[model samples]
Target: MTTLEQLLDLPRFSDLEILSAHKNLERKVESVEITETPDVANFIPKNAIVLTTAMIYKDDQSKMKHLLDTLVSKDVAALGIKVGRFIDDIDQDVVDYASKVDVPIVKVPSSQPLGRLLYQMLSYIWDAKTEQLTYALDIQKRFSGLLMHDVNLSRFIAELGKIINAPVILLSPWHKVISNSQYFSRSDHPASFYIEQIDDHHYDKINEGNSSFIVKDLKGENVQVLGYPVNVDTYFPFHLIILKPEQIPYPVSEFAIEQAILVLTFILFKNYKVDEFFDIMKSDFLSQLIKAKTDQTHDHRNWVDLGSRYGLVHSKYYRLALAYCVPNKDNKTKLIYRQEEAAIAKKWLEAQLPLRIKNVIIFKVKNTNEIALLFQSQEPDANKVLQTLADELKEALSIQLCFAFGNPYEAITNISSSFIEAKSALDEATRLFNPNVVNYYHPKGLVGLFENTNEESIHYYCEKILKDLAYPNDQSQKELRNTLKHYLDYNCEITKTATALYLHRNTIKYRIKQCEKLLGLSVKDPENSLNLRLALELSESGNESSEQAEPGA
Candidate 1:
């Protein structure tokens, strides 16, 4: 990683004259070689700084001019020629030509530096390689030690941030700030305020090179932002955001980012494997419990004990919540990436939710975009706490999460009922996609009725009950269906229904009369009203399903 200019500053070569092409001194030197032959271009590989005498030209200045072109093509790092011996001075034309080709041509102080220069370059390369290896080993030792001791994740991240004196943030695959790093430890505002300034395209650019990029402020202030991608060993579900030190020079900042990513990979990859093992076992147990396939021999002690070990306690009420993901355009293209996103998301939620809710068991629902968690709450206002937890999660990550809960299950053995209820709520939320999210545990009215209804049966029942009411001819006007539903919603109170619809009472009456004539049923009768309400629910569900089935949707 040391550039040619840095290698040249070996203290031994401090007296060497840097004559021309000073700007090219930043070229990185990989190795060093000596050449005294006229065809020196063929003697060295790319990034090798050449040490040679004037005998390299064989007394031909034309060949020397041509040699500069050859070195440029060969990708030579720089040329340090011993002067005042064979060739008095590097002629004006040669210096100009070297400058034009961006080749730094330096004059050696003496021809006797052969022994010292070679030793120095080799020493520098060896030292750099040693430092890199040592850094890698040290990172693994510290981070892995923490993992072994079950250290808090915030502590894990805080240690890294301190090592470099820079604020660090970790983001999930969908660009949600997961860690809520020390960057905001003293601040109340969300990470989105600062994160919004940097675009995801920055991630794509840095990832292309598999390295870091420093963005400088355009107004000439010394502020810089360093972007680094942290793949969980080729799984791109997260990235580490680093705030570049405004005063500290680069390569150091760059080196820190690189080193941190290595440590992160080591820690996360190992944890991922460990988490995968436990998740599979835990998920299997949950699945079995939900399906009533418990082991009868042990009286389900194994299941109960396993759940207890994972902190799935039972109190006055046990609630199940299923988190559903809102798929974006990019998620469709990268299935594996999307899966890891959900997996990492589950881990993130698991880590933080426990700090608030003491008794919770969180796990992914197996190859699905759903994450399920069961928690025990003893408080009288249990649902309030659950609702706030869901809201805070959505706001903190800035993610659109559709949550469904199951009504409180008193017995742990009957928790399967809660799972079924939550799943039903999630499915209906996905279909209706209304309110974009369902905050509560229970589904009501038409949404609840069509929870598991088949598409054809729903359409059939609506068509039969509503007659021509379901098929509104004017595409923009869903007037009749909506009006009838709202009328029944207000218990056939014309004034209340009209105000809710933002229409005149006379208009609402006319629509109801139209519906009565079309369906051959009056809203005044309780039996007829029940059928009308059921028809409306089916009709709405059918319409929603149709939208999802649209060609380009």
Candidate 2:
């Protein structure tokens, strides 16, 4: 119960009359003394209504002045002066002083005992208490009913506004107006205008345990504002309830309006979860669409073989890629709803990009990092699709992104290769001196190493080079192999390859020449160079050792 109600309910104040007096009368009675000594002034509480006879004053001018000074300092609520006990008549000076000071002074005649007056005062106090309690209980019941009935948030807010007799507005964490009550709408008020008027900095200041009141100018008019943070243990960081017409005495009842807002927030969050449930169902449906599209082109039997070869039948292929985009500091900074937003972003990618890509994934890699477009797609222009996806993502999410396109292979057997190449391309893209899209297979300086060549042949070439380096008295063999491997790895960038091996440009040139002389093949001729490298790799393998050793046994 409120302090006023508690004071009114006290039995000692049963006969109290709450005088409808001006500030002058209140100040007059506030100066009247009920205690003999000025020290007792300190004993009176701030809100206490003191009743007394003027015996303490004794009608001495100096003594009366001293008593009044003490009473004023103590801030007594209302002073009831018993007039007939000593003075036989109410003093004109006291009455005039009480009126001037705006204190309600009751003229208690001697015929009316002090006990009877006290009884009447206490009864009046009890009635006021009952009235306030009734009002508070009614408000509580209304809120409880709203909660139990699962009232819509908008309607609930409107009802609360009516209860408080003020205009109310609810804003999302983004400061976007979600709902308001009827009173606000009826007052020629523009909802968007108020939403825009809200200071974002102030909105951010709200938390579960804090509330504040402020005066703000809205659309040319000053409004009293009481804003409280609504905390609901759900997806939203906070729900804001704003009240206007600050004069409305938001009673200091512990049954805060935030309790109502929190309940509404829960309902809204539950509904949002339901919406997300449907979104996931849609995502699953899109995944099926991608699988169906791919199935039309490749035989199912091939998938089985690929899966078996790669030991990936049970491996859920969550196709994924990484991309760099322009940072949206605002949206990115308040990155709530991560999983839901990612799911939606994935669907958006599928709808906008080529249908061949499936299971597209987009998620935050770090504060400024982006991981995007993990899906199964077999478009020949998969790299182009990745670029388009980055563009769409920038447009949709308001962020610019750089993409690393994983290989679009039909079978899971090649996922490892695709992931490695994609990662390398991503690294290359990040490190490139120029601004251009980079793909795994189309790396600027390293394309030759990753060309569509037989894996066995490539492995054989590495083996041959290593074997040749181990030969007796072949001092140039190691340098030659290093040069070839670096050249292949860097796609023939003389600067990069030489730098990588910590060798001078001239040294790299000399090694290449040595490799040509030893292999009897043109080092620069693409076909001849590949054949020589393959042969070298095969020669390094120990299969020939077993054959030679067996014959000797």
Q: What RMSD, rounded to one decimal, does every model reach?
A: 11.4, 13.6
After TM-score superposition, what is the CA distance of residue 477 in candidate 1 from its true location, in Å?
28
lDDT (10s digit) by residue, model 1, range 458-518? 7887788887777566643366777777889899999987777667878888888987887
lDDT of each: 0.69, 0.53
Backbone clash total for model 2 is 40
- The number of the candidate with the highest lDDT is 1
- Stretches > 4 Å off in candidate 2: 1-151, 195-201, 218-221, 233-236, 245-256, 286-465, 468-475, 478-553
Scanning candidate 2 in windows of ten residues, the lowest lDDT window is 544-553
For model 1, the run of ten residues with the poorest summed lDDT: 544-553
TM-scores of all predicted structures: 0.55, 0.45
Per-residue accuracy of model 2 over 180-295 as CA lDDT, tens digit each: 87876666656666555556455555553545645445456566566666544333344455556443453423344545555666766776577557545534433333354345
